[model samples]
Target: MKTRIATAVLAAALLTACARDPQPASLPPAPSATSTATSTAVAEPCASVITRMSERERLAQLLVVGVDPADPDAAVRLVREQQVGGVFIGGNATALLRNNALDAVQHAARWGVSIAVDEEGGRVQRIDELDGTLPSARTMARTKTVDQVRAAGRERGAQLRARGVTVDFAPSLDVSSQPDDGPIGDRSFSSDPAVVRAYGLAFAAGLRDAGITPVFKHFPGHGHAEGDSHAGQVTTPALASLRTVDLVPYQDVAGFDGGAVMVGHLTVPGLTDGVPASLSPAAYRLLREDYHFTGPVLTDDLGAMKAITGTYRLPDAVLHALLAGADQALWSSGGNVSAVLDRLQQAVDSGELPATRVTDALGRILPAKHACG
Candidate 1:
């Protein structure tokens, strides 16, 4: 274990030394799908906002809390007082309910907060009634052309944007090689890596065309995992297989300017020391060094997932995530966000966690928020 950690730390240092800032590039064109929004100008530079914020406020910006429709007041408090950076709408939040809640939260926030939803279509659809449904990713890959998939993405994005959603966590990039795989299965585009890449890019392109930021998810692949991360920590394929097969889509999408990536909770034996990727600095190092992803890296739900809660509770899990290199820690189960924010402030004050980590995280997160506007 000591040797492995040393090797991982060395690899990260080397990757950092060799890393170059990525040149901004336009998304590759699909048949009829062109990006509606360009990176011409950010309305408010994230750097400016970071300079003006207090340490606690800056830390708040790195948290994406899950809002429940049942407790609208608590959700509003999270945004208004805690100054949470974003909200993920789920748990009985229909379109109307979600929109109403978002309106209230936005009204409470001093700055624009990202409104995200898991609108992947098919089974993972969060707001089916409001956004409507398309088709499963597998079915879309099998039956539709790449252009058609792009069109579907545009259509979905339009619905989400209309309802005030800025981020759509769709276009699963995990190569579903095994049909009977526990978590991914039909959520994936195809068993073939090439097919998954083509369709995933198309779907992401469509989302970008509609002015919704597309977040490609389950980084380093989840298709081959034997168990679900939501239930407990699941082991994944070795690094070689992940780089060649699962990580290809992420590497391909790195050139596009308007996309984010969500790291999952699976434990990679050789890479993360059996810790879930969301809380593994080694896993994040791989994403930064191996994949060259510069955009915001969000965690899968932090509160409900047993992989996290079964081990560390709220504020501890949140701290580990930030320390592990995630730009945003997503807590989908409702709780007093202020408590977590306070703990983060204390950690930073006592030299337990560096202030630069908060600033660096905000540097990545604020730009995404700016892009949403």
Candidate 2:
């Protein structure tokens, strides 16, 4: 045993000698002082508390649920009890003073949770009062200039960031191919995929510039769906055609750092039989492999889609979502809090959802927090 241990120690010493030093012993001869400074400075590591949160705390980082701003006590209870990874403020919460909302959200952030908002213009505006009046996405699209969209996005981002909103679920990338899509009609840029791609990229860049992370939403195209996803089933056409059109913008912006995606609840028969995109292995696979999307993936709302809720119970939805490759699950109703947590914990215990995956998501969750904080 001693001989073996001695051999192992000597081998470890040899490997250590071969490893490259993390901090350079000497600085590179540089073209300029600025270049040298830029090259030598490393990014600040994540906060130690965030890195070392308990299993429950880490799990909390995977949620972005709704809360009522009027009920401050209830809101605090939700945060303390639900172990939410984050809270997504809706119009109900947005109606409060921006500073008050910031105070509430930052309080959640202090416990290592993210604070997010919709803030998509047109019918989807949440923080319009804080961000100046928001223009409909259709109006921006009508300008036919990336600059128009970028400017609006930047301003919206700045305002939200000022209020401690870390994630802005904006720049609806779905191409409104079916002009009759009720919820997504003018909210979409245009029927033309190329135009949407250009505008979406510009908008995403603008949000990044304003120090807020943007989430590309309704992936695999909500444009082709015939019915609304809020109630019943909404199916789309072929995945091939949808990808080339509705998904083009998403593909274009997938490489942007700090840019994540929100998978809608709509089902595409061509992609995953009848499963909603949020729980579709097919959709997640496409996002991961085809689009090469390396950032986090979140559900639009687990409680909103019948395709999801009908097929799986709250806990089942949570388990299947993680299994299907979603990094986080959004629940709109506060009643589902315990169910969501129990489901996630059950998944972790069963080995169906590995702790490593949950931890990996926890790490990604932090960057968004730091970006917003």
Candidate 3:
């Protein structure tokens, strides 16, 4: 048990490290069919709903705050007092996840709170103790055919769905052949771009088929990158290197029905200009304009990740992501909910994070969470 976990810890070191500035401003072909349905098409009642919300609530809605998983009441307090839009159960904090643990949190909210977890099988699962263990992404990819992989994903997604979880952060899209102990390692499906694409989409489809919102992560790509973002900033090959390899899987990303995206904090040469992608507008442009991904976009864990923390404070880090075009900023360490929200509120008033951006973000967020009540 120790060996498997330790191996996975090293293996899953950091499969999420791809966000750089941008190389070009060119727009890709028309977004895929599903891409057209992104929150940008939001209309009517939801817009009115946003107007009715308080500045604090509006800002809170864009946040997916991490919370203490041992104390169910802590989640309730966040929703009732701070009115946060979502609560994340990070690490192995399972005490609050049992027996409808999140029901109370939802009941306390006017909109609703999204309960999320890293049930990425292999190394990064939060429900292993409760749900039976599953193999890692690499193992499944090597042994299972695409159909079999989809079925496996469905089985696992069903287990997660039964536990009242709405989001599953899985099906890492990074392309890599780094050592099994490297940052991405076995967490990635394969080093070959085609194998990664077929099996990756199949697994994600399985999760979505089971009614779970799978989050395709670590864009523009983290595989083959240097180091782990958890320890410090990471760098990826130049944009030219990624054009043929890492970015291929994302070209057909419109296939991930009812899914979301998690950008990395990678420094790309022609793109991010040395800063992490999470805070770089150029990076967001690459995703939104180049990749044509209009779904709800989230930053990697800002509250805890060193790639982001070593520079900006939590509040500033989140603000930069929002200003840069990310719809939501996630911090899974779960502290200072009030302080973050206060900072966001101040930004809106001071014109740092304009009210229009807040509303534009909500157009994407409220629909994704079904929180427009």
Candidate 4:
């Protein structure tokens, strides 16, 4: 009986030892100071992927590519395959395209993607493919009071919201100092900077009223650039003159909560010795350090102009633009999307571009999105 008791005691001891030796625990690292605060925290895999990106992925995130809204696969590919952050809606102004556009936007959004469109009035309008397009900024500048412009903006924004577009690149703040400048002559609100400021603010307010966002473009002013920024290298001496005259409109929009500012691909000797504004750190500094414009900064289409296409490889230009200050690299063909991203990843891997800068820039873009929500 004592022998039996000894065996049972031994078994009991063994069970106690087993209970004391617990399996290894699996716990995540504690939140660190370097990590994003809980309030602005991004999703895990996405945030991790974004933070610990291979050069390929960083470039992909910087790009906002254009795609057909009708093709759900294209939109899904942009988000899932390419990991693109945004998609620019591209379709002719037609009933079919317009009718189907919103559905496409909803699909893209389901995958945590954002949608953008060029809803600038007149020749630049995209939403008008289904409804009637509004008159040019020049036409509006001639007859409209601030109230009238504001009212039109609200209505235009409503149309945009109904179509699933949240961002409108509008209110050409260029002063139209050069009457003969073909592309912007009709797009500018007025030759007077004060009038431009009033109209630009009203237009922005109108969009805000409808819970939509606006992107004011061609910073430091595109008014005096001698050629179309879309087609070729545009150079202008008035870039200096615009510091006070044409840029005044931007000064008014500068306080905009979530508005994005697009830098044009024009050469302004006063600001950038020879490099276009879109690729110039000096020009970007004027926005970031000098004026303290703390918002998402986008480059005018990297694929559109000869200035960009003729001089720098689209991928290299995209890297330079982001390194310089532009947050979102705009591209049209969607093909350049991958190449642009690859270059960015390469730059990050090479340590030529700091990851922190890219993160900060992307962070700036998020607020505008929140504003849209």
Which candidate number would show the highest lDDT if scored against the true structure? 3
Instruction: Summarize candidate 3's per-residue lDDT along 196-278 as a digit string, tens digits.
Output: 98988999999889988888888889996887888888999999889899999998886555888888888888888788877
For candidate 1, lDDT tens digit of each residue in 1-373?
A: 0001122332333244213222224321111101111112223465666667888888888898766555567667778887888987664346324535567777788777888877776666755655566788898998999999999999889878877788988778988765533378778998888999999999999999999999888887887776776677778888877887877777787787899988888888688777788888877778877777777888887766677666765676778788778888986655547767877888788876677677777767777767223
- Span of ten consecutive residues with least summed lDDT in model 3: 28-37
TM-score ranking of the models = 3, 1, 2, 4
Q: Which residue ranges in model 4 land beyond 4 Å of their true spot? A: 1-58, 69-72, 91-111, 177-181, 371-373
| Runs with alpha carbons beyond 4 Å of true place in candidate 2 | 1-51, 92-97, 177-181, 371-373
TM, every model? 0.84, 0.81, 0.88, 0.80
Writing each residue's lDDT as its tens digit, candidate 4 over 148-216 gives 999999999887777667777776787885553366777788889898888887887898788777778
Model 1, backbone clash pairs (residues 3+ apart or across chains), number: 0
True-structure lDDT of candidate 4: 0.66
lDDT, candidate 3, at 203: 92
Model 1 worst lDDT window (10 residues): 29-38
The pairs that clash in candidate 3 are 18-264, 19-277, 21-271, 21-272, 22-271
Each candidate's lDDT (Cα)?
Answer: 0.73, 0.66, 0.76, 0.66
Kindly provide the TM-score of model 4 when superposed on the true structure, using C-alpha atoms. Answer: 0.80
